[model samples]
Target chain A: MQIRPLYDRVIVKRIEAQRTTASGIVIPDSAAEKPEQGEIVAVGSGRLLQDGTLRPLQLEVGDRVLFGKYAGQTVKVDGEELLVMREEDVMGVLEADAGTTRKAA
Target chain B: MQIRPLYDRVIVKRIEAQRTTASGIVIPDSAAEKPEQGEIVAVGSGRLLQDGTLRPLQLEVGDRVLFGKYAGQTVKVDGEELLVMREEDVMGVLEADAGTTRKAA
Candidate 1:
């Protein structure tokens, strides 16, 4: 199903860790911690507030964001992992200027 | 530490469960599902986007919101469970209708 997040909602595809690391050893899924970040997938239009006004969002798709451990409902689209959440849920987009970058799979 | 969420960031304190329940039998921590929502605490002043302007937030404190599971970072303030997540992380404010009023502890 094509679940479109309306009104400032964003869909994110979480980046999965290729392999588990523990003291330079590889661990299995049964022992690995769930990844807590994701890449933006789909985004929503701005929302209309209480004053009969509209508020625009600053974030865009493809931005990687960090989230709380227990946040966002899980879903899959076209066999891809995804999470549907509000644009506000995105704690912050990780700046690309930092050395931290998404590892290529 | 006072974690002020600037620029549309919101701090949420997850409401905890009073007693467990299941088929009339009380379930313990191991079986109960973690509540995937929280009450708004701190808020950011909204962000300035690429267009060099500011945007306002729509939600407010005391508004219970639903978030995707595995969203936001975990933090504690004054011995209370708090989460510093982006306002965008809030999937939606749970509408207070259809008998979904939270059971008071």
Candidate 2:
């Protein structure tokens, strides 16, 4: 089934962090924290205004974004674990040049 | 210290849910889930684009918004608990006529 978020909501696929540290020590899944990075799959049209106008979202599908560890609700869509959150829950989109080492705060 | 969110970030004050249910049952604090509603206290200028232009945020200070549970990072500002989230995290703004009973999904 296809899923479409209403309003300013977005569907994100979490990007798992690398299991190994720079020192090459591998971290087990049981000890690893959930990654705060994700790639946008779909975005809502925009926010519904009091005046009934729809405001477009700044993010586009395929943009990599960062969020708080606890942000968004985990949902299983088509057997895939995905996250659905409002645009505000997204901290910022990563530029292409931003390396993976950068952590979003 | 004064807090100013950069980019499309927003600072919100959570609006507590009503303790008493419609049946007059009082839910204790420990049993109460964190409310998904909030009032915007401050908003950032906008999101930064790759071209260096800033996109304005759709929300304004004092607007009541609804978000998913665990949508933002909680911070203590001036001894009060506040949430800082991206503008995209805000699902929708409540209209003055929208009653309090309407839960944001």
Candidate 3:
């Protein structure tokens, strides 16, 4: 199935919740919680402002992002899981290349 | 438990996944998947750009928004479920007052 989100919306493939922690602890999927991250698969052109012009997303396809557990609309595209959500739902592009990991304070 | 998200992040309470369709078809929570919508409860100052300036969010507290299914970090605050995610993780503020329900294209 083909999918496209309109106006600053994005389609994401959730990085399945981790099956293990940093210390080699095994966490079963059923026992594992949903993840807060994902890989960007598709993106909308950006948000359309009240003025009718588009303010495109700063992020590009393939950017790693962190989102809320219950953020986007659930859809099964081509039998693969996908999320259809707004660009605003995305908090920021994860700077994996930044070499510094940050946590919520 | 007290919760705070850092930099351009926001916390939301997922509007519980619907147990029924808009037309009254009951869908179980387990049979039902997670929800795509939520109520904004907390927010961060904003994203810090490369220039070291803050790019604050346009949204304020209490806005209804649409987010991805598996977007933010899951947490239970005061026994209520919450998602601690970045503001950028938010795609956009849901305009519940706008009177138009937009669907993904």
- For all candidates listed, what's the TM-score of chain B alone? 0.75, 0.81, 0.75
RMSD of each predicted structure: 12.5, 13.1, 13.7
Candidate 3 chain A: worst 10 consecutive residues by lDDT? A96-105
- Docking quality level of the chain pair in candidate 3: incorrect
Candidate 1, residues A5-102: lDDT per residue as tens digits? 78867788887766745567777655777776678877777655655555665556777676666667888777866888776666655543521222
Task: Rank candidates by TM-score, best first.
Answer: 2, 1, 3
Candidate number that wins on DockQ, 1 or 2: 1
For candidate 1, write residues B1-105 as lDDT tens digits.
344454657777786665545567766645667788788765665554544345656767678889887877775444556777777788978765864665442
Question: Deviation in angstroms for A87 in model 1?
Answer: 1.7
Worst 10 residues of 1 chain B by lDDT: B45-54
Give a tens-digit lDDT track for model 3, residues A1-105. Answer: 678778878888888755778999988867877776777888887566666666656556897676677889989977888888876676555442421133321
Question: Chain A of candidate 1 scores what in TM-score?
Answer: 0.75
C-alpha lDDT (0 to 100) for residue A96 of candidate 3: 23
- TM-score for every candidate vs. truth? 0.48, 0.49, 0.47
- Model 3 RMSD, rounded to 1 decimal: 13.7
Q: What is the C-alpha lDDT of each candidate?
A: 0.66, 0.76, 0.68
Off by over 4 Å in 3: A21-26, A99-105, B1-105
Query: How high a TM-score does candidate 1 get?
Result: 0.48
